[model samples]
Target: NITTDTLTIAGAGLISTAMSGDTLTISTTATADQNLWATFNADTGTTTANTTTDTLTVSGGTGISTSITGDILTITTPALLNVVEDGTPVLGGNLDVGASSLVKSTNVILSFSSGGEAAVNWTDISTALTGSGPIIRSVGADTNVDLVLDTKGTGDIDVSTNKIVNVVNPTANQDAATKNYVDTTTATTAQGTLADTALQNIVEDGSPQLGAQLDVAGNGLGDGTNLLLDFVEDASAVNHIEIENEATGSGPIIRAVGADTNIDLKLTPKGTGAISVADATNYETNVTADDDIPNKKFCDDTYAPLHDTINAQTGTTYTLVLTDDGKLVTMNNASANTLTIPTDASVAFPIGTRIDVMMIGVGVTTVTGDTGVTGCARLAEQGILIGRR
Candidate 1:
């Protein structure tokens, strides 16, 4: 049972006490530090009657500090940062160190690691930093390692106008060669002055001229086996001689060809040597044209006749053939007999061909001409003689 004036509160700046008919009430006052003290008292609310007084302590951690004056508590924080040694600190903004260098020890190497991969050390090669600039090269101990410069996606490594010098002489087919190596090797090998002269003579000269005697050692001049060696005129397209080598089981051929249909390939022998064929057995058989050559057997049987051999014709009608030239024909028929003379197109008797005809029987034999036979009036009138003049 407490009256309005029965309850008393000594800390008037922090709290206020009031009584209403048998109940008591304690409340926080409106002050600057009211919220701080209210939270502190609420955290330590368990208290008994006549208990020991509780002390509210405010301490600092790392870069923070706390202080207490007459009735106020002060928490002091540092202006600079002091991070823990073992913790990873993430900065939301840029960390700029003004006018100071970030230094590392000589033995410590800077590396890059990404995507949970092992870190690779930077600048493994030793560089000479004096003179013009640094010469990027391999280190002393790593003699076998190669220095490769790779480009990113479709990018090219351009050297601009500079040349890569001091290259070694190439031994492989695909290796790069230096200008000095090419000049030195060409001068000493077979491709020297003589080859240059030969190539220049062939390409620059208009006439057919040779610097030296042409020698076909093993290979031929034209296209290889079974090809033609054509000798052409400079202006004429149709006039040429094609000398062709035959394939297996055939002889070689030399033919004259031109726009004229009939052309002759004449071989005039030097110094009275006769035009002779080496193969005597395989002679030219089909002798039809005027320029055709007759073999020995055909000349002996057809043209050169035996004077004493007489061809006795017992039939009534007899025709003169090519074999009848330079021979005597005797007609022996009981009835009147007729001896026919053929045209030059059928039998092709040579000029000055003579055939002697005699009437043996009592029948009077008369010589006649075929349809196209001309200049045979004397022979057609008299059957005693038949000649082609």
Candidate 2:
């Protein structure tokens, strides 16, 4: 049996009792005036008439039951002193992050509140603290404990200061153009480069000329010296250096300007001579002017046929020499002019020479063929005569 506001001893001992605010004063004798009650050996006391309103108090306690789900550390069994904080919790003593690991669950947030609402909520630092952070052991401790350098996603962890500071960004990702090299953007590939064409770029202070963009000529990145235009290949490799007109056709001639124009483009060879044309006489070490073409072949360059489109009235005789590649000769009779030809011996045209006679004049402009030559004179009016003579 249990009772409140009274005390009873198991052994034959005197009991004393007094009522206070929320404390019951009981003595070993029934004298009714004892402030402090101390339990002695072999003395078991009980209060009868028990109800749920009865209270039991313990003075000092340790190793009480505790549970932790996330940051809310709850005490299941009451401790000797239970402190609850409805407002801001003021730490009266130093908080020791004990030797145990301060582990945090995934995505667990540590929120800072002001005026009952969270002003700033820090997202998951579990990986940042545990993963990247280091561990240090004390002088005599068994294991190590991690000292987290709160590595938020915004900045890098400052190793020197052992804290998370802003990352020192490379020249890229900066809005200004003050950097010499951008570490962010990648270099551009050639845009449909010709097999023989070389690439070029312009630069200043080791940076690209046009920031991160390529020019119209598809020349980007560092200076043109970054890549040289040296043509190199094996014997069968027919490498050509061509000047482009645009993306589609040929452009202006690429010429050596200023004082450099006088220097000859001397091709150093392996077995024979300097520069060869059509496998003919190979030139020696130096050319004619040491720069100019040394007696080029009698064949013409890649140019159109050179002849008079008008009639030949001033000259008494006409002469033509047949080249390896053929030529197109146009003879238009001018007004009132009769074109004459010399004898077959004086005019000496090759046997396979092709003659084109086109009469475009309204007047009767007569043309005399080679005198003393056994050939038929076939002339057409308002037409072109094409035959091999």
**lDDT, residue 333, candidate 2:** 44
Kindly report which residue stretches of model 2 are placed more than 4 angstroms away from their true locations once superposed. 1-79, 83-86, 102-228, 233-389
Sum up the clashes in candidate 1: 0
TM-score for each of the candidates: 0.32, 0.22
Error of 1 at 47 (Å): 44
Return the lDDT, model 1, position 176.
Answer: 72
RMSD of each: 15.1, 21.2
User: What TM-score does candidate 1 reach?
Assistant: 0.32
Tens digits of lDDT, candidate 2, 186-238: 33444223322222343423432332443559644323442323333355544
Please give, for residues 288-353, the per-residue lDDT of candidate 1 as tens digits: 678877777556655565444578999989898888877888888778888888887878888767
